[model samples]
Target: MSKTDFSASQLIEIAKALAASGQNFIWVVKNGEKTEGEDREEWLPEGFEKKMQGNGLIIRGWAPQMLILDHEAVGGFMTHCGWNSALEGITAGVPMVTWPLSAEQFYNEKLITDVLKIGVAVGAQEWSRGERKILVKMEEIEHAITELMVGEEAEGLRNRTRALKEMARRATEVEGSSYCDLNSLLGDLRAMNLPATRTG
Candidate 1:
């Protein structure tokens, strides 16, 4: 879940979907003082923690997201499609269930689901910055998770993500495209500052 404001109802729905998915998961539910008048008891589906027991772990507040993504047991990611989160998912080679919220998140979602073909959409439509509630129902969320985590389609997504992971890794190496480009840029800048070459 995003650090951005999400309605209590939205939280409840997401919890229900994760429970219904029947796959083991770790959910980070941001911990803070309850919203103005909100009840913590109503934040999740009834008996959610108890029901999830051994199958799921819900961490209140911060969890080590990059570490979790790097674990081999992690099959997929349910994300808000923020740029940093998207990049983490790519580097970890995990496909995603994209639920865009605001800013450039929707664009990130499209890049993940459409251009990259390494994610599935949870059907979150409108953009919001907490001014309005954006709800993606349990069924839609579960379907997207299933799409990203099960069968042949899921394997294909994983393969593509792994390929991207390799590419990203290579881009950081000294001989890689990004490394070469940066060095080239530095050379250009250095040349430009070399106290203008003497003219004949």
Candidate 2:
């Protein structure tokens, strides 16, 4: 449910994918205001939402995404590859289908897909910075979402995501990597007489 922007072609593709997948989804159109016009039907394929009404909940405006991702029913996410959203999905132990919008999100997608092995790339792995944009076909999106949701091929992705979630949780505990690193830094500062080590 990470339709980050209003790409008409991409949206249509996503609509088709959602319709074809037959999985339960909560799609959030982030910038629905862009379609405030008479040609709204043209904006989204006619009868698309109606056909999908049974299994999909298409929200036109804001949504509580963090809470939704945290839910047990949400097994995967359609992500824009934004770092914050990526981290949030990981924290929620949900795997992602990466659809990077622009900028460094492409890199983040790679980290998740290649390095972390916790996600699958939907489309547009190239960088888009107002100069060029890649249109991801509906079939690719459909395949990506299907694989993520219930394709049985996504078990590895889910397992890796859960492992990462545990690692992230452990990193915050008193004896974890993050906690130890913070203490080490503080100890060094204390040795240097830095006031940052003292209680305020």
C-alpha TM-score for every candidate: 0.90, 0.82
The weakest ten consecutive residues by lDDT in model 2 span 32-41
Q: Put down candidate 2 lDDT per residue, 37-134, tens digits, no spaces.
A: 33334667888778777788878668998899989888898888899999999988999999886778989999988999878788775565443357
Residue-level lDDT of model 1, residues 33-152, one tens digit each, is 465369655687778899999999988888899999999999999888989999999999999999888899999998998999999999989888764455678899889988888856
Cα lDDT computed for each candidate against the true fold:
0.87, 0.80
Instruction: Extract clashing residue pairs from model 2.
Output: none
What lDDT does model 2 reach? 0.80
Instruction: Extract clashing residue pairs from model 1.
Output: none
Cα displacement (Å) at residue 46, model 2: 1.4
Against the true structure, candidate 1 has what lDDT? 0.87
Model 2 segments beyond 4 Å from truth? 1-4, 35-42, 131-133, 183-200
